[model samples]
Target: MKKKSTNNKKTAICGVLIALAMILSYLESLIPISFAVPGIKLGLANLVTIVALKKLGVKAATIISTGRIVLSGILFSNISVIIYSLAGAAFSIIVMVVVDRMRVFSVTGVSICGAIAHNAGQLLVAAFMLENVNVLYYMSVLGIAGAISGAFIGILASIIIKNITFSI
Candidate 1:
Protein backbone atom coordinates (compact mmCIF):
# COMPACT_ATOMS: atom_id res chain seq x y z
CA MET A 1 0.00 0.00 0.00
CA LYS A 2 0.99 3.63 -0.46
CA LYS A 3 0.83 4.17 3.28
CA LYS A 4 3.28 1.36 3.93
CA SER A 5 5.66 2.70 1.32
CA THR A 6 5.43 6.14 2.79
CA ASN A 7 6.21 4.84 6.24
CA ASN A 8 9.21 2.98 4.89
CA LYS A 9 10.45 6.12 3.21
CA LYS A 10 10.02 8.07 6.38
CA THR A 11 11.93 5.47 8.34
CA ALA A 12 14.76 5.59 5.84
CA ILE A 13 14.91 9.35 5.95
CA CYS A 14 14.95 9.33 9.74
CA GLY A 15 17.84 6.90 9.74
CA VAL A 16 19.81 9.09 7.37
CA LEU A 17 19.13 12.18 9.43
CA ILE A 18 20.26 10.38 12.57
CA ALA A 19 23.48 9.43 10.87
CA LEU A 20 23.98 12.97 9.68
CA ALA A 21 23.45 14.30 13.18
CA MET A 22 25.99 11.87 14.57
CA ILE A 23 28.51 12.90 11.94
CA LEU A 24 27.97 16.53 12.81
CA SER A 25 28.51 15.72 16.47
CA TYR A 26 31.80 14.02 15.66
CA LEU A 27 32.88 16.88 13.47
CA GLU A 28 32.00 19.36 16.17
CA SER A 29 34.24 17.59 18.64
CA LEU A 30 37.09 17.86 16.22
CA ILE A 31 36.70 21.62 15.71
CA PRO A 32 38.37 22.69 18.99
CA ILE A 33 36.04 25.64 19.30
CA SER A 34 36.23 26.16 23.03
CA PHE A 35 35.62 29.16 25.23
CA ALA A 36 36.81 30.52 28.54
CA VAL A 37 33.42 29.99 30.10
CA PRO A 38 33.53 26.25 29.39
CA GLY A 39 30.99 24.08 27.56
CA ILE A 40 30.72 26.50 24.68
CA LYS A 41 30.79 25.33 21.12
CA LEU A 42 29.08 26.06 17.80
CA GLY A 43 26.41 23.39 18.37
CA LEU A 44 26.85 22.09 14.85
CA ALA A 45 24.76 18.97 15.37
CA ASN A 46 21.84 21.24 16.11
CA LEU A 47 21.78 22.17 12.44
CA VAL A 48 20.50 18.71 11.63
CA THR A 49 18.05 18.87 14.51
CA ILE A 50 16.55 22.13 13.35
CA VAL A 51 16.33 20.92 9.79
CA ALA A 52 14.70 17.69 10.94
CA LEU A 53 12.25 19.58 13.08
CA LYS A 54 11.20 21.69 10.13
CA LYS A 55 11.02 18.83 7.68
CA LEU A 56 9.86 15.81 9.68
CA GLY A 57 8.00 17.28 12.64
CA VAL A 58 8.62 17.19 16.39
CA LYS A 59 8.72 13.42 16.93
CA ALA A 60 11.29 12.90 14.23
CA ALA A 61 13.36 15.82 15.38
CA THR A 62 13.33 14.58 18.96
CA ILE A 63 14.30 11.11 17.87
CA ILE A 64 17.13 12.39 15.71
CA SER A 65 18.40 14.63 18.48
CA THR A 66 18.25 11.83 21.07
CA GLY A 67 19.84 9.39 18.70
CA ARG A 68 22.73 11.76 18.05
CA ILE A 69 23.32 12.42 21.75
CA VAL A 70 23.20 8.77 22.75
CA LEU A 71 25.32 7.56 19.90
CA SER A 72 27.89 10.27 20.34
CA GLY A 73 27.94 9.80 24.09
CA ILE A 74 28.57 6.09 23.74
CA LEU A 75 31.39 6.52 21.26
CA PHE A 76 33.06 9.81 22.13
CA SER A 77 31.98 10.92 25.62
CA ASN A 78 30.66 9.66 28.96
CA ILE A 79 27.52 9.40 31.06
CA SER A 80 27.89 12.92 32.42
CA VAL A 81 28.10 14.28 28.92
CA ILE A 82 24.99 12.33 28.03
CA ILE A 83 23.12 13.81 30.95
CA TYR A 84 24.00 17.37 30.04
CA SER A 85 23.23 16.77 26.38
CA LEU A 86 19.85 15.21 27.11
CA ALA A 87 18.82 18.07 29.29
CA GLY A 88 19.93 20.60 26.72
CA ALA A 89 18.33 18.74 23.86
CA ALA A 90 15.05 18.35 25.71
CA PHE A 91 14.85 22.02 26.51
CA SER A 92 15.97 23.02 23.04
CA ILE A 93 13.39 20.86 21.27
CA ILE A 94 10.54 21.96 23.51
CA VAL A 95 11.23 25.64 23.02
CA MET A 96 11.78 25.25 19.28
CA VAL A 97 8.50 23.40 18.85
CA VAL A 98 6.60 26.00 20.78
CA VAL A 99 8.25 28.89 19.03
CA ASP A 100 7.89 27.36 15.61
CA ARG A 101 4.21 26.69 16.25
CA MET A 102 3.62 30.33 17.12
CA ARG A 103 4.69 31.36 13.59
CA VAL A 104 5.86 34.68 14.94
CA PHE A 105 9.49 34.21 14.02
CA SER A 106 11.52 32.67 11.28
CA VAL A 107 13.61 29.52 11.68
CA THR A 108 16.46 31.73 12.78
CA GLY A 109 14.42 33.09 15.65
CA VAL A 110 13.30 29.64 16.68
CA SER A 111 16.88 28.50 16.71
CA ILE A 112 17.96 31.43 18.83
CA CYS A 113 15.35 30.61 21.41
CA GLY A 114 16.21 26.91 21.28
CA ALA A 115 19.89 27.55 21.77
CA ILE A 116 19.30 29.76 24.78
CA ALA A 117 16.98 27.18 26.28
CA HIS A 118 19.57 24.48 25.67
CA ASN A 119 22.21 26.41 27.53
CA ALA A 120 19.87 27.12 30.40
CA GLY A 121 18.97 23.47 30.72
CA GLN A 122 22.59 22.40 30.76
CA LEU A 123 23.45 25.06 33.28
CA LEU A 124 20.60 23.89 35.47
CA VAL A 125 21.94 20.35 35.43
CA ALA A 126 25.47 21.53 36.05
CA ALA A 127 24.36 23.62 39.00
CA PHE A 128 22.47 20.70 40.47
CA MET A 129 25.31 18.26 39.97
CA LEU A 130 27.95 20.62 41.33
CA GLU A 131 25.66 21.85 44.07
CA ASN A 132 26.68 25.40 43.41
CA VAL A 133 24.21 28.08 42.52
CA ASN A 134 27.09 30.25 41.43
CA VAL A 135 27.18 28.35 38.19
CA LEU A 136 24.07 30.24 37.24
CA TYR A 137 26.34 33.19 36.64
CA TYR A 138 27.37 31.56 33.39
CA MET A 139 23.95 32.18 31.89
CA SER A 140 24.62 35.65 30.59
CA VAL A 141 27.73 34.54 28.75
CA LEU A 142 26.23 31.30 27.53
CA GLY A 143 23.03 33.00 26.46
CA ILE A 144 24.90 35.33 24.18
CA ALA A 145 26.85 32.43 22.75
CA GLY A 146 23.61 30.55 22.25
CA ALA A 147 22.00 33.38 20.37
CA ILE A 148 24.97 33.66 18.08
CA SER A 149 25.39 29.95 17.45
CA GLY A 150 21.66 29.43 17.15
CA ALA A 151 21.48 32.11 14.54
CA PHE A 152 24.17 30.35 12.56
CA ILE A 153 22.44 26.99 12.76
CA GLY A 154 19.10 28.56 11.96
CA ILE A 155 20.43 30.17 8.84
CA LEU A 156 21.87 26.89 7.67
CA ALA A 157 18.61 25.14 8.46
CA SER A 158 16.66 27.72 6.53
CA ILE A 159 18.83 27.19 3.51
CA ILE A 160 18.57 23.42 3.70
CA ILE A 161 14.82 23.52 4.21
CA LYS A 162 14.41 25.70 1.20
CA ASN A 163 16.38 23.37 -1.01
CA ILE A 164 14.67 20.17 0.00
CA THR A 165 11.95 18.93 -2.30
CA PHE A 166 10.58 16.00 -0.36
CA SER A 167 7.76 15.85 2.13
CA ILE A 168 7.30 13.82 5.28
Candidate 2:
Protein backbone atom coordinates (compact mmCIF):
# COMPACT_ATOMS: atom_id res chain seq x y z
CA MET A 1 0.00 0.00 0.00
CA LYS A 2 2.78 2.40 0.86
CA LYS A 3 4.51 1.53 -2.39
CA LYS A 4 1.34 2.19 -4.30
CA SER A 5 0.96 5.52 -2.59
CA THR A 6 4.48 6.44 -3.52
CA ASN A 7 3.84 5.50 -7.13
CA ASN A 8 0.75 7.67 -7.18
CA LYS A 9 2.66 10.58 -5.80
CA LYS A 10 5.39 10.07 -8.32
CA THR A 11 2.89 10.01 -11.13
CA ALA A 12 1.26 13.18 -9.93
CA ILE A 13 4.56 14.96 -9.61
CA CYS A 14 5.62 13.86 -13.09
CA GLY A 15 2.37 15.16 -14.54
CA VAL A 16 2.73 18.53 -12.89
CA LEU A 17 6.38 18.87 -13.80
CA ILE A 18 5.75 17.90 -17.43
CA ALA A 19 3.01 20.49 -17.63
CA LEU A 20 5.30 23.09 -16.10
CA ALA A 21 8.09 22.22 -18.53
CA MET A 22 5.75 22.54 -21.53
CA ILE A 23 4.51 25.87 -20.28
CA LEU A 24 8.06 27.08 -19.86
CA SER A 25 8.84 25.91 -23.40
CA TYR A 26 5.95 27.97 -24.70
CA LEU A 27 6.90 30.97 -22.64
CA GLU A 28 10.49 30.70 -23.75
CA SER A 29 9.41 30.66 -27.37
CA LEU A 30 7.59 33.91 -26.78
CA ILE A 31 10.78 35.61 -25.58
CA PRO A 32 13.35 36.54 -28.20
CA ILE A 33 16.95 36.57 -27.09
CA SER A 34 18.11 37.95 -30.46
CA PHE A 35 21.72 36.93 -30.04
CA ALA A 36 24.06 37.07 -33.01
CA VAL A 37 24.14 33.30 -32.79
CA PRO A 38 21.20 31.79 -34.65
CA GLY A 39 20.31 29.01 -32.18
CA ILE A 40 20.88 30.69 -28.89
CA LYS A 41 18.18 30.75 -26.24
CA LEU A 42 18.20 30.75 -22.45
CA GLY A 43 16.77 27.19 -22.27
CA LEU A 44 14.14 28.16 -19.77
CA ALA A 45 12.54 24.71 -19.70
CA ASN A 46 15.79 23.22 -18.45
CA LEU A 47 15.05 24.71 -15.06
CA VAL A 48 12.34 22.12 -14.59
CA THR A 49 14.59 19.29 -15.73
CA ILE A 50 17.24 20.26 -13.24
CA VAL A 51 14.71 20.48 -10.46
CA ALA A 52 13.13 17.17 -11.45
CA LEU A 53 16.47 15.41 -11.62
CA LYS A 54 17.41 16.60 -8.17
CA LYS A 55 14.05 16.02 -6.56
CA LEU A 56 12.68 12.99 -8.38
CA GLY A 57 15.70 10.99 -9.57
CA VAL A 58 16.87 10.09 -13.08
CA LYS A 59 14.00 7.90 -14.24
CA ALA A 60 11.36 10.38 -13.25
CA ALA A 61 13.42 13.20 -14.61
CA THR A 62 13.86 11.36 -17.89
CA ILE A 63 10.15 10.82 -18.18
CA ILE A 64 9.47 14.45 -17.49
CA SER A 65 12.14 15.64 -19.89
CA THR A 66 11.10 13.45 -22.82
CA GLY A 67 7.43 14.06 -22.14
CA ARG A 68 7.92 17.79 -22.28
CA ILE A 69 10.03 17.63 -25.43
CA VAL A 70 7.50 15.50 -27.32
CA LEU A 71 4.44 17.40 -26.16
CA SER A 72 5.96 20.82 -26.68
CA GLY A 73 7.31 19.83 -30.07
CA ILE A 74 3.94 18.62 -31.30
CA LEU A 75 2.04 21.58 -29.95
CA PHE A 76 4.40 24.52 -30.43
CA SER A 77 6.86 23.58 -33.17
CA ASN A 78 7.47 21.19 -36.05
CA ILE A 79 9.12 17.84 -36.68
CA SER A 80 12.52 19.41 -37.15
CA VAL A 81 12.29 21.09 -33.78
CA ILE A 82 11.29 17.81 -32.19
CA ILE A 83 14.25 15.99 -33.67
CA TYR A 84 16.72 18.64 -32.54
CA SER A 85 15.16 18.86 -29.12
CA LEU A 86 15.25 15.13 -28.62
CA ALA A 87 18.89 14.98 -29.57
CA GLY A 88 19.81 17.85 -27.30
CA ALA A 89 17.70 16.54 -24.46
CA ALA A 90 19.19 13.09 -24.78
CA PHE A 91 22.71 14.51 -24.49
CA SER A 92 21.78 16.92 -21.74
CA ILE A 93 20.16 14.35 -19.47
CA ILE A 94 22.93 11.85 -19.95
CA VAL A 95 25.58 14.38 -18.94
CA MET A 96 23.51 15.63 -16.04
CA VAL A 97 23.01 12.13 -14.67
CA VAL A 98 26.68 11.29 -14.95
CA VAL A 99 27.86 14.55 -13.43
CA ASP A 100 25.30 14.34 -10.69
CA ARG A 101 26.26 10.78 -9.80
CA MET A 102 29.94 11.75 -9.54
CA ARG A 103 29.03 13.95 -6.59
CA VAL A 104 31.89 16.29 -7.38
CA PHE A 105 29.82 19.20 -8.63
CA SER A 106 26.81 21.05 -7.37
CA VAL A 107 23.68 21.53 -9.42
CA THR A 108 25.31 24.53 -11.06
CA GLY A 109 28.17 22.44 -12.32
CA VAL A 110 25.84 19.74 -13.53
CA SER A 111 23.72 22.32 -15.28
CA ILE A 112 26.76 23.75 -16.99
CA CYS A 113 27.77 20.33 -18.19
CA GLY A 114 24.26 19.51 -19.33
CA ALA A 115 23.89 22.79 -21.19
CA ILE A 116 27.16 22.34 -23.02
CA ALA A 117 26.27 18.79 -23.91
CA HIS A 118 22.88 19.88 -25.16
CA ASN A 119 24.42 22.37 -27.52
CA ALA A 120 26.94 19.88 -28.78
CA GLY A 121 24.21 17.36 -29.43
CA GLN A 122 22.19 19.85 -31.41
CA LEU A 123 25.19 20.90 -33.44
CA LEU A 124 26.03 17.32 -34.21
CA VAL A 125 22.53 16.80 -35.48
CA ALA A 126 22.73 19.92 -37.56
CA ALA A 127 25.96 18.74 -39.09
CA PHE A 128 24.49 15.38 -39.92
CA MET A 129 21.36 16.89 -41.40
CA LEU A 130 23.23 19.46 -43.44
CA GLU A 131 25.99 17.07 -44.48
CA ASN A 132 28.53 19.68 -43.56
CA VAL A 133 31.01 20.01 -40.71
CA ASN A 134 30.58 23.77 -40.62
CA VAL A 135 27.69 23.42 -38.24
CA LEU A 136 30.17 22.53 -35.53
CA TYR A 137 31.78 25.95 -35.91
CA TYR A 138 29.02 27.25 -33.70
CA MET A 139 30.11 25.08 -30.77
CA SER A 140 32.47 27.54 -29.12
CA VAL A 141 29.93 30.32 -29.22
CA LEU A 142 27.11 28.03 -28.18
CA GLY A 143 29.19 26.57 -25.38
CA ILE A 144 29.68 29.98 -23.85
CA ALA A 145 25.99 30.71 -24.18
CA GLY A 146 25.17 27.33 -22.65
CA ALA A 147 27.30 27.98 -19.60
CA ILE A 148 25.64 31.31 -19.01
CA SER A 149 22.12 30.02 -19.44
CA GLY A 150 22.89 26.87 -17.45
CA ALA A 151 24.19 28.86 -14.57
CA PHE A 152 21.06 30.96 -14.49
CA ILE A 153 18.82 27.91 -14.64
CA GLY A 154 20.93 26.08 -12.10
CA ILE A 155 20.70 28.90 -9.60
CA LEU A 156 16.95 28.91 -9.97
CA ALA A 157 16.84 25.14 -9.59
CA SER A 158 18.89 25.32 -6.44
CA ILE A 159 16.50 27.84 -4.99
CA ILE A 160 13.49 25.75 -5.90
CA ILE A 161 15.01 22.55 -4.55
CA LYS A 162 16.03 24.20 -1.30
CA ASN A 163 12.71 25.90 -0.69
CA ILE A 164 10.29 23.16 -1.55
CA THR A 165 8.96 21.60 1.64
CA PHE A 166 7.13 18.60 0.27
CA SER A 167 8.49 15.44 -1.28
CA ILE A 168 7.49 14.43 -4.80
**Total backbone collisions, model 1:** 0
Question: Which consecutive 10 residues in model 1 have the weakest lDDT in total?
Answer: 30-39
Q: Write the per-residue lDDT of candidate 1 for residues 114-153, one digit (tens) a residue.
A: 9999999999999999999998998999999999999999
lDDT of 2 at 141: 93
TM-score of each: 0.95, 0.96
TM-score of 1: 0.95
Model 2, residue 156: distance off in Å is: 1.0
RMSD values for the candidates in order, in angstroms, are 1.2, 1.1
Each model's C-alpha lDDT?
Answer: 0.90, 0.90
Write the residue-wise lDDT of candidate 2 on 16-82 in tens digits. 9899988887888788885877658889889989988988889988999999989888887899999
